[model samples]
Target chain A: MRVASALLISAVASGCSGNQSALDPHGAPAIHMEHLIIGIVAICTVIWVVVMVMLGVALLRGPRAAADTAKSEAWLAMTVVAAVAATVIIIAGLTIASFYTTRDIGVPKSDALTITVRGQQWWWQVFYAGADATPGFQTANEIHIPIGTDVHLRLESADVIHSFWVPSLAGKQDLVPGRSNSMLLRAEKPGVYRGQCAEFCGLQHSHMAIMVVAEAPADYDRWAASQRGDATMPADPDAAAGRGAFLAKPCAACHTIRGTAANGTTGPDLTHIGSRLTIAAGLAETTRGSLAAWIADPQTLKPGNNMPMVPLTSAELQNISAYMESLK
Target chain B: MGAQNRLTERTIANPAPAFVAGALLLLIGVGALLGWLRQPRELRLDPPAVADLDQFRRMPNGISGTPPESYFALGKPYETDAYNLSQGKRLYTWFDCATCHGDGRGGAGPSFLDGWWLYGPEMVSIVASIRDGRPHGMPAFRSRMTIEQIWQLAGYVQTIGSYTPKIAAPSRNDNEHTRPAENRGPAIILFDEGPLGAHPDQGPSP
Candidate 1:
């Protein structure tokens, strides 16, 4: 019994707090949302308890005399009216609370940093708008934001509908095709908050995970500066051979590696793929082995996806994986 | 005892065997329909190259040779086949044709729904357009995709710009309701149930 109870407690406690749990909020918007959720739940619980108590009292005091029915009818009518009024008031209260919460969470400021996030079938294409002379560059899957700043996101979809949701940071906003939607996201704590496509977007939806890295302002600036530049030429001979292979194969037709002749728009931009925390939209941790495995057989890792299994020699595969890892 | 039995039987009507059989048949019908709707994944979904594919070798300026006349007409199942069209549709979205083409509406490229064929509405021209690419912004997909895959894409493209809606065209995506789906005919100004004169989706025979 004790062991079962301990296991149950651990299981319940596991979901109470995490990088992606709404219960443990780390941002102003999420904090507001959490408060609203808790408030509504408490209100509903109180109503349920009162209803159960009344039901218990009525059941316990069964078989009341018919003699006092005339007097009780008026009392019963008044009680029903009061109950109806209470229900209306409670519903109105919740509506107002949620309206205010949504307003507070979504209203974007004029000067908020605008980043256009386009949702493809299973990946995210992030384009940071240029500020002054600093030109904007494109990155895939990962979004980096400075802590304690409101960054406005312009959400759009490349194919089907996709929702952008980071439970630890802000509310969920959908990315619809042929239409533009915007959301303001601000993270108070500097941490990696994981997010996934809330909507079911075809076959690889579950593997379509994203990471929001909230860091110090200086650190964010440094990361952004690095991401904006072109991919450096491979210095090592193995990587050079890999680069040659990537260009010669169909990889050049789908993916774009900035600074190289590979300029294709079919797949994600791999200009800084090595710098990302995860590969294939958080399907696996970004490492040389995982990259090689993915390059070898993308169809197996995430089936029904666009990435075809390109035939490659074992040596060619090793060099290509190394070259991909060195893109950072 | 007989009177009592009659009274009980009269009070509650007993289910007829025909009714039970009809209900069972309905359930079976529903199960079959659902099974058909949710098409399960095939064992192999990747593009396996054809051994002999001498297509896309030479032309004036990237226009490949036309598919031979006796191709699918000779016992080969293609074009009108649902499986072939579905594979083509898969290649259509996955290869990012919708990126430049804007889901057949044509963003950077010409619109397929306009009924204006730049290189003629023939399947061979469409095949050449895809494999060899057009003169301007279009990119050749010879290296990336297989010949069968290209043919499938060409077949699907024909259905997109088709004057008459084909039975093999698949449904719309799982997202928000946009324009007329492949199954549905062209939409009106508001959307859906378009005018029947020129619209093939809701034609006179539909």
Candidate 2:
């Protein structure tokens, strides 16, 4: 019994406190919900213990003589009423709290940043809705947001039903075909938060991930400008060769690269791909080796992914890797 | 006498049995209530950390039919030396047909490998399907694949349209000249469902 109690205590403690590294700079809503849950659990535990003790005593003491039957009946009635009342209160409180936390929090009446996310089979397509005449920027996998600002996302699906969830940033929003849903999120600090598709799409669904990078306003503007094709590429022989190979192959048939001959709208835009921290929808860290591996055999890394294997010689792979590395 | 008998019966009745039965019933009722209360609240019960829920939603709509007998009849001695059905297998994957056909069992789409063909069993009808496409959701592949490739793909289909994987013939050697005669599986045949057993004209029927 002592060992069982110890194990239960440990489990409760660990479940209450998530991975600190993962929860750092989490928005107020998530933190608030966590505390509320813990409080509810503590109260329920106390009630459970008291009820059990009372039940044990009642069983051990045995029924009193016929004279005490009225008192026993009254006690039983009170216990039932108390349990019912407590359940109602707890349910009502949780529902209300969950509603307020998920509702739009302090979104300014002024124009908000609007982004559209389309969930495809095992991938995410992100499109920035630009103001005025500027063409909106398009990207995949990685999402960037300005720190201390409200951002609105319009979620949709290309093929199946998918859900967008960034546990530390916001609640999940479903992406359904032929319809769109909206969600609001903001970052309190300049840091990176991980997100993933919270819907099972296909064999490669696990590989679909997104990086939410919170940057300062100025840094965000710079990144946005580069995404608009204002960024210049370094004039290196290896990178140049890699660029040539990229344009020559079927990569151009699906992907779009700003300021280059490769311009296919079927897949993600690679205009400023090098600046992103991770690749393959957050399946791996952004490195030459990882990128090379993904390009060589996407199915091996992310099974059932749409991207087919592009046969590249070892030398060509190295050259492409070097070129992509130089993009940042 | 009747009143005395009733009093005696009441006194002889065993109270323990009645108490045990009542207790058992109460226990069962309480257990059921506890089970109901333990159910998880409100949250969607899908698997955690799913990458693409969209893809999963779309898959169920495809491949909704029953599997055909031809798939199960593969590799038998009588079934050998028949038409090469490999073309259908290639077509199955190429056209994303498996998405609906689903391993040849009718799922979202009608089962082609089965003896029953909604249109007709004739090659002309199948070829027409390749040209015009079906009403529900099947797309015409005329614009997508070359005639030669389609014919080759169709040739492969003939041998294995009902070819279930369990009794699949051993992989064939691609080189025709070097392969031994005994090793060669079957003679490729192109047949028309209609009277003409030869290739038809390209133009649509008037």
Candidate 3:
């Protein structure tokens, strides 16, 4: 029993230490929260132990048959004093921690990048803020930000309520339907972190995940620059046929690829889908096979998703997949 | 004995106090229920839309008494129910109709809430247009949405430019776009300045 208890305790302790964990924070806000959680857990454990010890003592030593009045009064006064002291300390600590953390986290920096993230039913419509000279480009699912730079996200929902939560980076903020909310995120290190729609949205909520790729400033800029360009035209005949098939089919009705007739906005923008890390709202790998399968039967992969199953022939599906692969 | 002396046991000894407390709570609950029941129904803020089948009778296709081919063969389901209209509105947004149609004011496609429709102002015509997309723009949705959904959308579309019974008052959180009143004809609205100099005979016409 002792061995099993030790193992279980270790497992629980290590569970929140993953790369995408709040306990293993990579950003300032997450770090603060992690400290706060640790402090709370420690204080609670101590309190529990003290309470248990008192219960044990009380049980082991029965109440006095004839208690001395002065001694009993002294014990009562001690207990009350200790309780009041603990309460005051706890309240002060919590208030100070909350005020500091709330003020610091999501505080916009002068050089912070502003991005708009529109939460669809099961996908993210991500858009970088446009400069005066350059129009903003739209992408889906994956968000690339510069490492160590504050990133502000304007959260909006195209449909139901969804939450933006990157546990290692920042706290969760709800994206309510028909209203816009904002949250700030920053990554201290250059690495990939998984994000999820923290809200319990409709079907396929588990599949509605996102990836945050924190790259170096130069790399992020290069990615942004490349993404701003229209989807590259496929040179291969099969890919060309795929593009043709895409335009000819109902695919064009709900997706958009810049510089093509497939300007649909009901779904996520596919201008840079080929270059993305994952597809189907981070549910599948970004591969030709997965892309083809997703296009063939979106309903199967994500039931109740807005993208209906488009009846495409096998050859056309392959062609479309090729064209999609050649998009970058 | 000392501990017992220090602490005093409290009990509800008076029945009057208990009865009075219970009565007050009951009265408050009854008052709240009555107030809620008497509250007036809120006005709906959805765009004015009415799906009347009478408009279809004016069409040549309707006069011939021959049902049009493809989806919505059973004819447009005149759905004025708030829930159904909201569903149709969701479909319209989901289908990305707002992209080309500029939130009901003309953009790449002609405005649905404006005068001078390229196709006649019949619900059936709207259904047909959606089924068979026009040239230059307007992607066909026949393969995507179900016929029932198309009919619902047609019902919602018909509501534009028409008065509707208010259901709920508009809230500040509502982000749905409302059509501007000065709905310039499609040509002007599409280009933002003047009509596209394209030949009037191009593609289908009203």
Per TM-score, the best of the predicted structures is 1
lDDT of 1 at A118: 96
Please give the range of 10 consecutive residues that has the lowest summed lDDT in model 1 chain B: B185-194
Q: Local distance difference test, per candidate?
A: 0.81, 0.62, 0.73
Arrange candidates by lDDT, descending.
Answer: 1, 3, 2
lDDT by residue for model 3 (B1-206), tens: 86665554333344678889999999999999998875232122111121222223335542123123321433223334444455567776677777887666768887665444566556666766676566677777776664445655765665553333233221121464354321122223333322654435433222
lDDT (tens digit, per residue) of candidate 3 on A51-107: 899899999998676568898889989999989999899879878977887888855
Model 3: clashing residue pairs?
B43-B167, B43-B168, B44-B166, B44-B167, B44-B168, B49-B159, B50-B159
Per residue, candidate 2 scores C-alpha lDDT tens digits across B29-144 of: 99999988652321111222111111121113222222223322422212232222332343445466668865444588865444345554333345445544768986776544
Position B103, candidate 2: lDDT: 45
Whole-model lDDT for model 3 versus the true structure?
Answer: 0.73
**Each prediction's TM-score versus the true structure:** 0.76, 0.60, 0.69
All models, DockQ values? 0.21, 0.03, 0.09
lDDT of 2: 0.62
Instruction: Show pairs that collide, candidate 1.
Output: B185-B201
Tens-digit per-residue lDDT, A32-104, candidate 2: 5555556668877987898899899989999767667788899989989998998898788877865665453
